[model samples]
Target: MTTSQNPTAQAPYKQLRRPTTDRMIAGVASGLGRYFDADPTLVRVIFAVVTVLTGGLAALTYPVIWFLMPEEPPTAPPWPTAATTAAPAAATTTPAPTMPVHGDRGPI
Candidate 1:
């Protein structure tokens, strides 16, 4: 008889993402305002007041939760941004004046 587990009552597996950078049409109210942390402009004003009191049928649940939400995967701008450390260092590969010379063609 030994049962007593309560280490912060486990609750850290949230995965409702959908944020390709503060989207407005398909981020699904900022991924449900960061999965219920709220304030994505209050879930876009509660989806514009439930699509104007359900007249637009609650805006059809925002395209059915943007087709069952699952997007957040584009984070790659911290190595050195500011146009990648102030840009200007990638210009050396010029060989394309319409180069396509195959003087041996026989394909019908």
Candidate 2:
């Protein structure tokens, strides 16, 4: 199956960044979610727990990511074409088999 393109696909990976829209606090979790190909909510929950356990030291790291991570441009979906839509039907059709000649016999 074809995979969707992400910011990493288009640009070089460096440090992680916060996502602009998906973020709950500072978008740090959303940025990590994009990098790791995971759900944003999961990352947020983990970070929240870490912050609580660390007595807010984990929370302090967020601003550093917020400043270091590059902003990702919004991606546009690929436009559907008639050929793309019809590809599945074409792929399902069977090809005709050729009969083997006596002298040219090989594995069927």
Candidate 3:
């Protein structure tokens, strides 16, 4: 007996992008996996097998896709720094505490 999956609901449209947050190397496999909704490990295995089978021709696609696929946007905003955030109110400069003079010795 053979079972066929009926196409019912459509998957949401996703851009072909290299994920910056979750990636191993250039993110090509991860990106393709995410785009196709498949396991990234499976994608990598397939990629390696194809690369070897195709005499490094498939491997060349890695760099090409890396160059073409845009990196996904950063998820979290950058933390506020001293320069970027508002500065505290400036306080008047205070003089250093004076020590009592000693007769050719140290502070008395």
Top candidate by lDDT: 3
The candidate that achieves the highest TM-score relative to the unseen native structure: 3
- Score each candidate by Cα lDDT: 0.73, 0.70, 0.76
Off by over 4 Å in 1: 1-17, 20-27, 31-39, 68-70, 74-108
Q: List per-candidate RMSD values in Å.
A: 13.6, 10.4, 16.0
Deviation from native of the Cα of residue 45 in model 2, angstroms: 0.4
Report the C-alpha displacement of residue 58, candidate 2, in angstroms.
Answer: 0.5
User: What is the per-residue lDDT of model 1 for residues 4-102, given as tens digits with 9 covering 90 to 100?
Assistant: 966434335766878788778778888788778776888899889889988989888788889988887675222223465564655655666875468
User: Across residues 1-108, which tens digit of lDDT does each residue of candidate 2 receive?
Assistant: 998766535334443655556668677777787678677889888988999999999988888877887765556222224556676866698988988787996866
Q: Give the TM-scores of the predictions, in the order they appear.
A: 0.28, 0.53, 0.57
The 10-residue segment with the lowest total lDDT in model 3: 75-84
Clashing pairs in 3: none
